[model samples]
Target: MMFLVITVISTFVLSNESSRIPFLNGDNFSDWKDKILLTLGCMYLDLALYVDEPPEPTVKSSIAEKSSYDKWKRSNRLSLMLIKSHISQSIRGSIPPSDKIKNYMRTIEEQFVSSNKALASTLMNKLSGMKHNNSKSVREHIIEMRDIAARLKSLGIEIF
Candidate 1:
């Protein structure tokens, strides 16, 4: 009885942790990707992200090889599902589907990397054109400027 309760609670906690990954809308890919990677790592499901797929087990495979293969397979399957589940439906249609987690992630990165260049340009223009305008508190205005700078930095652009 105690074991069953612990199992249920652990499952819920894990699910909740994954749920914290933000839905990948078209504009928020960078933030969404960061959260997804972090969440997968926390769940110990990021093995597929770092390791290439192992060859299928053969009849004479050693126990350790089989164990490693099984672990990689499970991680790939669950990580793929967790990633796809968090993508918004509108964006999902454009991504080429794949059973291999690495391929799927590559497709996602390809789709975003190009747009990030354009996004950086836009942010640069906005940051340069921004002015105090006297409508908001000076603190709020400075914070907003800092946020734009931070976003630009995340895209590999540094003003200094």
Candidate 2:
């Protein structure tokens, strides 16, 4: 009877001691939960950033290659632009215009304006340097011009 009592007491003491250790405390559990939540939140934000489809590859050198690349780029660009345009049109079509939609359209327009300016500058630079005799450089310049033209076309702006 004495031995049983001693054993029970010792077991209780050991358990209590172990539970008091910092590693086994309630604070550790809360810390772990916080870390897990932070990691998941970061992953969610990263996914949001890439929800849009990737831009199509644009570097190519042959007629077939150029055609395929241009087709893919144009398709992707059109898809993105259509998505934006549809959102704006839907807002304007509604009986009550949504401020949220109006703001979204404004943001999209601002982004497009800046992008167009950048593309125009790049095209002008490429055009200015057309005298290069290197086939590879000329091919790259043509591809750049094609991309700039496609981007402009997406914004309903024609580049002659």
Candidate 3:
């Protein structure tokens, strides 16, 4: 058998002069060579018995397969309508009815009440005696946009 041939060859290689150079004592040379040959033979036997096959690749659905655009479009439209309704109600003297937004605003107001009050007072003073104006300053518009985005995010809404 292949095992018998490998064992004989390993024994012969270990018995060679170069292999015996590591063991200066002749008394333990045979024992050391036997241990080395046994270890090498075991390693060869293990390698010969090993089963080698490539691992199978995991399959995953493509984006289009996983996401149906039609369903998403319908849901997105409903969400936009809900946001618009909330904004319209807020603009028409109706404080947003959503408890989530109210709670979020309460937390923000508690944290930044002094700063917010000062900012609001300054804005009111600026607009107090002004004629009808058609233009918005870039800074004011940017703040408004940021506030809108923050409100949306606080409501657990995914913008993207």
- Which prediction has the highest TM-score against the true structure? 1
Q: In candidate 1, where is summed lDDT lowest over 10 consecutive residues?
A: 6-15
| TM-score of candidate 3 on Cα atoms, chains taken together | 0.18
lDDT of 3 by residue, 20-86 (tens): 3333121222343344335334433222112222232334645554344333333334323322332
What global local distance difference test value does model 3 have?
0.39
User: Order of all candidates by TM-score, from best down to worst?
Assistant: 1, 2, 3
Candidates 2 and 3, the one with greater lDDT: 2
- Which pairs clash (backbone N, Cα, C closer than 3 Å) in model 1? none
Structural similarity to truth (TM-score) of each candidate: 0.87, 0.27, 0.18
Please give, for residues 1-160, the per-residue lDDT of candidate 1 as tens digits: 9999976875786688877888998667888989988888877889999999998999999999999999899989998999999999989999998988888999999999988988998999999999998899999999998999999988989876
Best by lDDT: 1
Off by over 4 Å in 1: 1-10
lDDT of 2 by residue, 6-28 (tens): 76875565444333333212112
